[model samples]
Target: MIVAAVPRFRHIVAEVWRPLAALFVWDVAVTIVYYRLPFHAPELPLTLFGTALALFLGFRSNSAYQRWWEGRTLWGAMINASRSLARAARNFLPEPHAHDLKRTIVLRQIAYANALRCQLRRQPVDAQVLRFLSHGEAEPALARTNIANGLVDGTGRRIADAVRAGWLDTIQQTQLESVLVDIANAQGGMERLKNTPLPAQYRFFPTLFTHMFCVLLPIGLVETLGFATPLGSTVAGLMFLAVLRIGDDLVDPFANTVHDVPLSAMCRTIEIDLLQAIGDSAPEPLQPVKGVLW
Candidate 1:
């Protein structure tokens, strides 16, 4: 979400000013409290602690990014599945039914995109969803607790109806049904990442570690470089602050931020792609600043 070309230090201050400021105040307080205590390096393992913190945050960032990328890739696969679904319909339906079915399925595929973005962002599916399905279909589609899953189920139901109508051969029905399963799995995976929060322990440790490090760093430097304690503390605080904010920003990639996944833009892309598959001219590409999609 952090796309600005600004220095990371500046970006950190911008994204995490409040927390970093609080850490600064806390650092001063710690320095005062521990002033009476003689500076004892004690072969104090500051470097070891710093290394551990770095590793912990790196691992955390990697895990969070994996979830974000997985969600994006899942939607990419859904786009493919939707197009493939259309192709599969044309393969089996009688000529008259096939064209309508293709539109129906493809339009519904577009609805699925909007519904999913809304679902992920905790927004309601809007009138755009109705652009694809009739009121009878739309009502039931929106009634389910999970709009994304509901739309996915609707796709499967359409295929089932086709099988009942004798439009699709059994093997073809199964093949398309498998696609539905993959779509459902993608939704489930997104939901899993969304609902299952980052481990509380992981978040807690770095936060504690960062604060403790910044709080002690001044003293460690003070013995070697007198009267520069405040400046030294400020520098150490900024470094830890930058690292912490970067980790925090990446921690929840689904959260709405410059850094969060651009689900709305992605859903729009699916809409355009589905329309193209149906022979509609594609709309102009979206323009974004800082190389980021909305």
Candidate 2:
């Protein structure tokens, strides 16, 4: 994802150049027709169209931003839930074994975060993920269809073992279980956002309207701008299409795009916190490469 401190014009142009090129071509064609064919389309209707298109684009952008915000909030909750679970394990479990088991469970939490991050992005588990899992758990977790679920399962088993060994009483077990349940809820929310997209019509209609607006823009402007119609229309067209593209970028927050929620960075933050909680010197938190945290 792009993390530049200032928005770069070159990057913006690179992303939507094809569509902008089409807009430029359409505008030039309309300008030629206005001068050569002695034909002029009324501009009044174009004004109304632009207004409606603006409203439609606004609604679509808002909806997409909501999805992105929800994804960020869910990850924030996961961070809190993970810390709570580790704190509970450290406080409630009995001695020497407690340290080892707490560390084990914390490491599993880290692995789970990485697994979920990889799953959402449809990427292979990274070495950072394997580093957090025990030798026994790592291979099996990697082999599973849902690696995050496998890690969660291992976490549950570890909780069971703690209870069975009387390291934690039923009340303490229940507390830890509650935190686990919250983690699972956060996971389910993440999966829901990843698996379900905005309605097709929602994505389709706004894009259609934006392009329609771009096509008609030069036609409307040709009579007024004369020779300058092409340049004016291209600039105007770029604005409307840029908003539409921004909405598209935000609609899928897990796609690992520059505009996504920075899942990798978030996962790393959780790892750092959990690792430090267990007295291990955690790796430094990830810094944005350009201006992007991911």
Candidate 3:
């Protein structure tokens, strides 16, 4: 996500340039028609239209922001649960005897975080995943339809095995299992947000009305503004256009865009923490590039 103190002007312009260009052209055309042609510009209730359009865009923007925030919140929960799982495995499992198992569980947790990140963004299992998982483990897990969920299942089985081997008692097993469940719930929430989108009315009507308002803007102001119609109308129309674009930018928080949640950075955080917990050498945390964390 954009982490700059102030985003560059070019970045802001890039988002809405297409609509801005269209509005400017339409405004100029309307001004020319009013001055050169015999067309009488109809008086429109522009103030009322602008008020209602603002409300529509406001509602859509609120909904989109909520989706974006919820995605971030879910990832936060995932991070916490992963740390808890790693700590539990490290402390609860009998040391020296279950040393390899403890390390395996922690590494698998890191792998699960990266796998979930890839799954949410619809990306393939990459080196990040393979780095944590062994060839035997990765082969079977990658064969499954949902690799993240498969990794969770594999971890659960290993935990169950630890309990059977007397490395962890039933109580300790339940505690670790609860942490896994939290991770699974967080994954489910992210998947739901990625799968289901904002309703059609919310997506369609605000955009339609915003463009319609821009079209009527120049025509409505031509008589009053006269030669300044293009300037006045284009500036007024840009406000609504910019607001409309805000909703589009935030609608999908997992779209792998600059506006999206920084899944790669977040995954890196889990990897660093879990590896450090198990006394393994961990990589540095991901840093933002060009002011975007993703």
Q: Pick the candidate with the highest lDDT.
A: 3
Which structure among the candidates has the greatest TM-score?
Answer: 3
TM-score, cand. 2 vs. native: 0.95
Worst 10 residues of 2 by lDDT: 126-135
- The parts of candidate 1 lying over 4 Å away from their true place are 2-11, 23-45
TM-score per candidate, chains pooled = 0.84, 0.95, 0.97
What's model 3's TM-score?
Answer: 0.97
Error of 2 at 166 (Å): 0.8
Query: What is the lDDT, from 0 to 100, of the residue 96 in candidate 2?
Result: 82
Name the lDDT value of residue 114 in candidate 2: 89
What is the per-residue lDDT of model 1 for residues 1-294, given as tens digits with 9 covering 90 to 100? 444555445545687678667756765664564566665533456678778777876777777677777767776777777777766765666777667776787777778877876667666675767866887767777888877677778778888888888788789888988877877887777778778877888778878877777766755655554455566667767776776776676655567667777776777777787777667786665656565666
lDDT of 1: 0.71
Ranking by lDDT: 3, 2, 1
Once model 1 is optimally superposed onto the true structure by TM-score, how far is the C-alpha of residue 81 displaced, in angstroms?
2.1
lDDT of 2 by residue, 1-294 (tens): 557767678768977899999888888888887778877578568878888999999999999999999999999999899889878877777778677888888889988888899889988875756777767767767778888887887788889998898898888878888988998999999899989999999988998878878877887888889889889999988889889998989988899877889898888888888888878898887888766668
Q: Given candidate 2, what's the lDDT at residue 293?
A: 68
Instruction: For model 2, state the Cα shift of residue 271 in Å.
Output: 1.3
Runs in model 3 deviating more than 4 A are: none
Candidate 2's error at 161, in angstroms? Answer: 0.9
